[model samples]
Every structure is written in structure tokens, then in C-alpha cells.
Target: MRHLIPLLFLAACASTQDPPRGPSLPDTCGAGDYSYLVGQPARALERVLIMEELRIIRPQTMVTMDYRAGRINFKISDQDIITDVTCG
Candidate 1:
């Protein structure tokens, strides 16, 4: 029985999934597609500000961006896991 308890504890500790945190973006944002916004100068500036709030991209950081399904996909540092993104 003691051994079983230790084994269960080890098994529980071994799980690697991160806990759920919160929403991907803020509530105030209404924009839907960033690709076209990237072309417009004013929207680009506003997008940068929103991205900062979302922690999706940092100021002056190099990120490969893509527009997918009305969201700005930001790839930073080469991990498949998306760190941050913003709505278009």
C-alpha cells in the first residue's frame, strides 16, 4: 500500500500539460484580420499596441507572422506552441 501511494504520486508529478490560464486576447479588441491591417499604417500601429497588451509579441522582437482564420499568428523562437497572437 505504501509503495502504491509513492507510485501514484510519481505518476501525478509526471504529467507535463500546462494548466489552463485565460483568454487568448482582450475583450476591448474588435478587429478581425491582421494581414490586411498590416498594410494600413494606422491599423498597424494600433495592432502593435494590442499585441503588447496580449503579450503575443514584444517591441522590436523578430517574429514570423501569418494571418490565419482572422487571427495574427506570431511565431517566435521556433517552437510550434504559439506564445501570443492578436485578432485582425
Candidate 2:
């Protein structure tokens, strides 16, 4: 198993590197352009169409930890205000 351990170590080392920049960025999902949406009423988004996978996360809501490429997350506060706009 000595030979296998070294190969596994190298594999683990490669995985430690930062992931490549992809369409998960704010611009990719157009979340950056919508930064102004923060602090506004969450209902304001109803008129804005983000032609990608959109998710609205409310307070105390349970969400999947899985990162979905090009997904835009709109976080809402308990008072129905937009808190954060980010890409997944």
C-alpha cells in the first residue's frame, strides 16, 4: 500500500487548489448589477427578470449547501427586505 498512499496524497494536494473562476460569479448571474436591490423590498424583484436559476432564501429558511453553477441567490430578511444578492 506504500505506492498507493503517495498517489492518494498527490490527488489530495491537487484538490486543495482554488477552483477555477467560472460563470458562478456575480456578473455571470447578473447579481452584481442588482446590488442596488439590497435594502429594497423583496417584492421589487418581481419586475426584474434574471434569466437564470434564481433562488429566494428567506430568514430561518433551510437551503441546500450544494453550489449550483450560474444560480443567483436573493436573500430576504424577516421584514421582507432584500439583504444580499450573490451567485452560487
Best candidate according to TM-score:
2
Candidate 1 residue runs with Cα over 4 Å from true position: 1-13, 24-27, 35-84
TM-score of each: 0.26, 0.66
**In candidate 1, how many Å is residue 32 off?**
3.0
Collision count of model 1: 4
Give candidate 1's error at residue 19 in angstroms: 1.4
Write candidate 1's Cα lDDT for 42-84 as tens digits.
3244435544223245445755554343444442333323333
> For residues 6-74, could you state the per-residue lDDT of candidate 2 as single tens digits?
999888878666888875443667788889999999989999977789899998889999987688999
Model 1 quality (TM-score): 0.26
Q: Rate the local accuracy (lDDT) of all candidates.
A: 0.46, 0.87
On a 0 to 100 scale, what is the lDDT of residue 38 in model 1? 34
